[model samples]
Target: MTVLKGARERWVRTGGTELCVAELGDPGRPVVVLVHGYPDSKEVWSEVAVRLADRFHVVLYDVRGHGRSSAPRPLRGGFTLEKLTDDFLAVVDAVSPDRPVHLVGHDWGSVQSWEFVTVERTKGRIASFTSMSGPSLDHFGHWINKRLTRPTPRRVGQLLGQGAKSWYVYLLHTPALPELAWRGPLGKRWPAILRRVEDVPGDGYPTSSLPSDAANGAWLYRDNVRTRLRRPRPDAHAHVPVQLITPLGDKFLSERLYDELEQWVPRLTRRTLSAKHWVPRTRPDRIASWITEFVTAVEVTGEPEPRATGRHAERFGGQLVLVTGAGSGIGRATAFAFAEAGARVIAVDRDPESAASTAGTARLIGAPEAWAETVDVSDEREMEKLAAKVHAEYGVLDVLVNNAGVGLSGSFFDTTSDDWRRVLDVNLWGVIHGCRLFGGRMAERGQGGHIVNTASAAAFQPSRVLPAYSTSKAAVLMLSACLRAELAGQGIGVTAICPGLVNTNITATATFVGVDAAEERRRQKRATRAYGLRNYPPEKVADAILRAVARNEAVVPVTPEARGAHALSRFAPRALRALARLQPPV
Candidate 1:
């Protein structure tokens, strides 16, 4: 029995071979056909297929000589790209004879589907293509030829790096030995290898046909790899929209292999995943989401949805990010930044309406999903409840931004104990609660994540007037550093973001301690005016936060003055101290 639970199965015959095809979802809906890779059957797509069944007509078929599909008499020349394309056409024609089908492929399936979409015979049959962990053999050949012809030091290095990753390809091309290995110990240990290295779940996948599948699938590389790479077709450009999903941690393929992919795919949307090569098995939710989005866009508009017009969109798309204090100012900007990069956003604020407003706008921008939560970060019980709710509702966070903080200004002598508690409660203690609860869950999951804490330039360049505020932010800075050291081994990155002054409403709501209410208002106005004169935007700080997470930086000084203060604190402490002691005009 196949692993796909509720599938309607049938057999299609083409060119002396019979393919086992499974259909899920309503037959009248737009069709989505999933093709499996080498050494595996259509069961590879079982998880992804079930997820998309609600919205589309989902189809999965075993390639010739794998799974329940019957093999050719001579496996040597039988698994060529031409034969694979014939098999694909037969399956689609049987499923949907009138309308074109959205095509998705992984590994060797993607390699052959590249031929299906690019060749003239099957051009009208495929409406769109979503490719993962595979490149068109023709494009790859052209890449190699160009690099070898006009070689630079960087190009030479790229060639060498990819060559090293292709060590398995060399081994697969060898005769008889691969079959012997597969029939012997390798076949039995294959499932364990997938579990340990790829983190694939033991769900009775690969079926009981493991040894036969492995032995027959070896011909996939031998039959097509050498022939395609040597005399590649020049007119192999795709006729439909292409979505390329690359796994950054794939041990067998370098990211640079797609450097010149734009020339081959005119309308290309690039996505990247942090997981290993087996994303269909490990990250099925993300894979299914991307495919659904891409297929729907093409169905509606005949092109890919307007691509995310933000920095690092490829790296951040489909990831879940949570931002604290997102009602306004820096927190709101950070949430919108992640949203623009196609991340699903959770906006947390003390105010309900404001958080809801941000989430609504995030969806309008580019986020596929967005939600708002009202919580006072200073309250431990509330934070605990919020963490539990978030984990249950949204799954593990890929990124967490702790940007909630209050501003306070007064002489050290005038700032009393209550003021100290208030400042520390929201700034320092809030960060602590977020990291302890949410971060604990992230670590327990053991998949890797990032945490960002918003400190201030006043942390290092302290001011006498900002005694309580400075103490709280300084504590946050140190806490981020210590936590970064602790979480480094688990692959979680921690960053402390410091900003000198950016134009936001924090100054308006800031407290002027040791003064009358009337005087406090006057001082607040003065401070807001001064910061407004600096004319910095909170969006820039948001960009810095995303960049820090992407690069795994320890400390980031966002503004020019913040960078200067950080440099002076390191190289010239006395000068920074002197500047901190001066009285403000207000």
Candidate 2:
């Protein structure tokens, strides 16, 4: 069965091979040609092609000896990089005769595309190139030569590391052994191996032709790898704009291999993902989104440049970040921080005007896209609806900040049951709702993401006067810990950010339970004034949130007092408990 539904299929004859090509979306639109790696076919890109079909003409073609494509006779000298380039050119000419096509490749496909984009023959035919999980053999050759010529401890270590990773390459090079193994037991267990090792979803992939495909694909390495690396072209610089997406967890390639990539590609945009090698199946949404953004930018400006220029720009750029309570204070500051880092911001708040205002500011702060969402997190239905909308419209959230909350101040005895419920509903349940709805989606996407729960120093320090508030934040801190443990295997990170005495509007809005209306106003004024005197800015907490997500930290204390209290709570609990018994200034 064909993996790509509703795709138009055709054949392109190129240099003693007939390539099986599949086309999706409107042919009149800009063409995006996807080339699959070895031991796979056009079907490897089925998921990504479907996603990209909406915006561009999506094309997937089997390489000369894989899938439905006919293998060349005498496989020993058939699958050279030059032959692959010819096959690529043939497909492009057949599918898009007049327009330059946007090129995307993975694994061995990316290896050949490096040749296509660099060589003078296919320069004008290619518009832009996006490479993932693959490197140019020419570049690899030069990198290996450099380390051999001037061996240092670090360089030698890198070479040894890469050499170890290339163990599979050595196996593939053994004559007739790869073909026998692949066509027999290895083929039967290949799909299971991919599922167990790469976490690739089992969804009608590996096609039934996998055994023959793998056997025929052995010639790819034998024909090209040794010859090209030993005598790499000196002028193998890329002539087109390039976007490189590196999978940090790929076992086959080292991140250091591309350290000198900038010398070959004049215009380069780099993106890294926390994933294994098979991103086409596991991270189709992110891959499609990045491809769309790069293609659109190149189409409009005729160049590829970074959209953001802030700290951690490469990590957060083109990612989606959602911040609750984003109208003001820590929520707003955190949104701006992610915006400056080039994330697409979703500013959500209880107040529509505040959310919209934050979104507007986020756009000005360098967010490629900003949207306002109004929802009360305390209401489960509202949060559920918001999560569905975000998933359906904006794609899975890369980062979620459950920052919306309320404060209730008073002794436990003086605080009414209703008051306790109200505070718990917003402060504790709000975070639970966000985690349940959005966090579930992140896990389901399988691309990994982060969650930042806004707690307080009161969680650990404790105060007699702020009983309800302290309990709610303490629950948040513990909840984050539990989630971090549970989701670690799935690549989701959870962090509880505790801030102390930040100068924000939460102080003025805090309800004074057990006080008269006039007394409540007076208490609010006093609390706000005291916090202002302390003068800790919310932006610092925002910074901590970003850093925590990047580092995948478990629990972060934002302010000086918060850090000290956390330290004390860990080592000197008796002092904290005794301090909790004292009367508060508020």
Worst 10 residues of 1 by lDDT: 441-450
Q: Estimate every model's Cα lDDT from 0 to 1.
A: 0.92, 0.92
TM-score of each: 0.86, 0.94
Which ten residues in a row are the worst by lDDT in model 2?
305-314
Model 2: CA > 4 A from native: 151-153, 514-523
Writing each residue's lDDT as its tens digit, candidate 1 over 248-301 gives 889888899999999999999999877788888877877898999999999999
Candidate 1, overall lDDT?
Answer: 0.92
> In model 2, what is the error at residue 466, expressed in angstroms?
3.0
What RMSD does each model have against the real structure?
Answer: 3.6, 2.3
In candidate 1, which residue ranges exceed 4 Å CA deviation? Answer: 1-3, 184-208, 318-320, 356-372, 380-398, 409-417, 432-449, 458-471, 474-494, 512-526, 560-586
Instruction: For model 1, give the RMSD to the true fold.
Output: 3.6
Clashes of 2: 0
